[model samples]
Target: MSVIPAELDGAVIPGGCADCNAEQHFRQDEPGMWFIGIAHDDWCPTWRRIQAQRAGLPTTFLS
Candidate 1:
């Protein structure tokens, strides 16, 4: 039930949570990888789940 804010429409990275406003950057110096500039709200559940996954933490606690 997350909705992307109007200002961020069409700008979010593909497959990212709707509540995420993080910017995706592809730097020439770091080719072949995409960078995320996090701008999500601190309390966003989807963002928290993503972080947990990245850290190898269980996501079962997240809804």
Candidate 2:
């Protein structure tokens, strides 16, 4: 269960983690991990798995 930290409420960074600073997340192995006082899910794992499972289907794209 990942919840946005109170300190990062309303924080915004283009191309970076929506919940934390982008510069802090440097580990390539877990690119989806965001540095918000801890390794938080910038992109939720369940959603990532779902996206992976649906990969290569034309419906995955949007018009």
Q: Residue 4's C-alpha lDDT in candidate 1?
A: 30
Per-residue alpha-carbon lDDT of model 2 for 1-36, expressed as tens digits? 335444443344333335543332222223334443
Query: Model 1, range 1-63, lDDT digits (tens) per residue?
Result: 223333343355544447755544322223333344545666778779777779884568666
Badly placed stretches (over 4 Å) of model 1 are 1-17, 20-38, 57-63
**Candidate 1 clashes between residue pairs 3 or more apart in a chain or in different chains:** none
Per-prediction count of colliding residue pairs? 0, 0
Regions of model 2 farther than 4 Å from truth: 1-42, 56-63
TM-score of 1: 0.34
Predicted structure 2: lDDT:
0.44
Score each candidate by Cα lDDT.
0.52, 0.44
